[model samples]
Target: MGLTQTQKAMVEKARAAGGSGQAIPLSDDACVCLIGIIARDLGLSDHFPELPSDLPPFFDQREPGSLNISGVEFLPLMERLVKLNPDSDTFFSCLANLHKRRLKYERILQTQPIPTIEQVGPRGLLQFGTISATTLTGLLFWRKWFFDIDNRAGQETGYLFEPIIAHAIGGVPFSAKASPVRRAGDSRKGRQVDCIRQQKAYEFKIRVTIASSGQGRWQEELDFPVDCRQSRYTPVLVVLDATPNPKLDQLEAAFLRQQGEVYKGESAWEHLESVAGPTMGLFLEKYVRDPIQALLNKVSDCLPEFVARMDKDGITLSVAGESMLIRRTLGAADDEVQELPDDASDQIPGP
Candidate 1:
């Protein structure tokens, strides 16, 4: 097939690196075919069935029964492929293979005597040590989950932190009401809280664009709930913004500039502390400590009733107790097992 401009450039680069008199075991024609296969697999091209007439003469020349390329040559080609098609499934698959290779390489290294700082050079040792420490800390897993596309459904409704908090707490205790309730003799209807746990109200806001007055627009939205005296529920406000504002500064600063404040305006922050609550930072810390176990805890608490309902519909609860098994398998003995109210549903509000 006709090489795309990118593929042609990649070929030229490889030839330039190979230089004159460099005997590459793989024929240029074979390399082109391999590139075509890779491109098709990555969904980069659909014209792989037929070879194009306009291919460079280098690709046309061939005296090959089998193709071979050294690891040095293959590495550059793979790097180029990854750079060009990062989001492609083929690229991810290749990445996964590379990870496997890395694990194998680590195993080989482990068999040898551990190198001293002087032998490996202090900078090299420091880099390896930092990576090792980070991997052990489980930060990367949480970072991946935070940025994963599938988990971004909550962003649209300004409740992006709800799911993570809910999972950490083991279940969602309240559903978002479509309309706010206006009680008798009230000046305005009470603004709806995002979600409630144990009758304690929570509001989630994202301050991406600040208003002209150097304050978040959501700050205005908080006035009703924060000032609602008639309501029995204690309110808490969670804001996701990076700017320095008095409201956020007064609140407990979460990692990455996120902030959480228990509605201390009319009620004490301590009022909601006893009722299934954590500052946004603490909740995130727990989540980062172990997300799989956190999620499994949520599933364990919520899945029983779901399994029962499935049984009524003639569907089997095949995965019963698996969440607990996962927790045990992962050696998560230190995790606090939360038992949510059986009647509380774990479903979060959809965007």
Candidate 2:
């Protein structure tokens, strides 16, 4: 995920340009056009490099000048996908392409060890225990399907509400529906209230999977209530390195085809929640933004370094702004798994 010689030069050129003191706002289409130019220049066609472990950059210095551009920073390029000549095909095409790159990044991290785990059995039992004796609230839910008999066709009708719930909470429903209230005055107790109340509550139990790493596994389940009538989710999924802890894990979800089956399985919600502890939104904040501040260390010219990394990490240009100051995280370290090329030094010679 480091920068190449060409990318380094591109950024340096922009640094020398002395840009207009205005932040340029590009639509998703503009972002893609920029990325297309970059990809071609980088020779990323037949094969693109895997994204670096340190992804989703966060930038701080919003200066009053034109920002630099480079091929290595794919996120800015990707932001343009929504801007292609014909919107429909390009938008989806951009998403699918980015998703594929994400998966490659996740696979790279799955093999590394930040913590350990042990698989118990296939009744689908696994365990995750914290290193220190600490209490952590792990959320859980289950994925389920209920069928009711339809009198008209003498066939069963499927209830399709669970997926909507799943998309929102990112966990299976674990809470159970309340029992139906007794019919109004069937016996002779007292009141005759003629209205029937329908209980629309359901819970999903999540089953978890643990790798064979040698460490005690902690297990817990939680219930997330979903009202299909209440909300809608922007069904997006991201794949990248990083192990799933009680707090978070990378998710591989899709709104289409078999990939959607990633949400299937009985009470597998427990497993889903174990991973769900972490959301992509959270990563967008912590990993990208926090890290940028940590890298800047309050120095100004070094701001460009932060910018290059930001573009490398996929920090949306629009969101980071043109001139903003980033404060360093209290004790952040350079845990970068890959090293960026010295784009600042390597420039082409003029004839």
Candidate 3:
């Protein structure tokens, strides 16, 4: 967004040395200047819309007449006014990713999920139900419906979370140029890395708790660290959930065998924030974590006792004698979710 402490220090150093707002030298290898250029095209920065263009006023150049990036061939990917930050906390931020993540949460709220009632089977209820059979049955239905939406949200979040965190820490989602171990008749390419910062290929996961992932998928997971090694990068595994699982153990063992680094739970968050620096860390907490926690709290308090009656069109969910018909389509604007354009931008209009 703006600048990291290290970047600020770089600016101060330049200013004190009569560098003014001038060009910094670009290198062949990954450096702060190149990193900043890559980081500029990302989200989770404090200065999203009203980006401070003047602060990070140093650009990367090879000669007085040549405007250059690390790879001369890829110079076009670098934009004008994209500045150098020693800490890789680029100059500007895009609201695109933040908007996309927010949209996933909004879709979860608007969606009126209705699982098949037949899923309950002949028993039509839980065996442990001692009182209020109807309420318990309704609760089970709600749980199933909620589960569908929750899983959908999780998958969508997976698609968004990588870049949001990756860019915040000045990394890019990487795809290995070549496959390390190609399968027979498989058209698949190299491993899709969550984030690649310099030579560190980071694999980010919320948690790995499945008892056994499918054999093919599990093997692919195991191959990730190997692919990173073959690509000449150090593997960094970041699992946000530390809950012990046999599957996670196996996958982690695979990484460790490849001399990879692993961080779990609090350590993972700390590692992300440590690289992301104070400003981007605070931005992530405020925009990403806080909103998610608030939504979880809101859902848990209400859904724990929710009663759903499903029919052909939709389902009627009742709580405390209040009923609302929910269809598969998006619901009416409520206190929680407001109507927003599909192309949500930095300038969100007041409702």
Who wins the TM-score comparison?
A: 3
> Per-residue lDDT tens digits of candidate 2, residues 1-351?
433454433323322311211112233333333344333333333333332222221122332121223335444334332232212222222222222222222222222221112221221232224322221111111000001101111110011122222322322222212112221223222111111112222222122334423332221111011111121211222212223443223222112221221233322333333432433223222423244345434545533422311223321223235433222122211122221122211111100
Badly placed stretches (over 4 Å) of model 2 are 1-239, 247-351
Ranked by lDDT, the better of candidates 1 and 2 is 1
Q: What are the lDDT figures for the candidates, one per model? A: 0.35, 0.25, 0.52
TM-score for each predicted model, relative to the true structure: 0.26, 0.18, 0.50
Model 1: clashing residue pairs?
A: 1-51
Q: Which sections of candidate 3 miss by over 4 Å?
A: 1-96, 104-151, 175-188, 288-303, 309-351
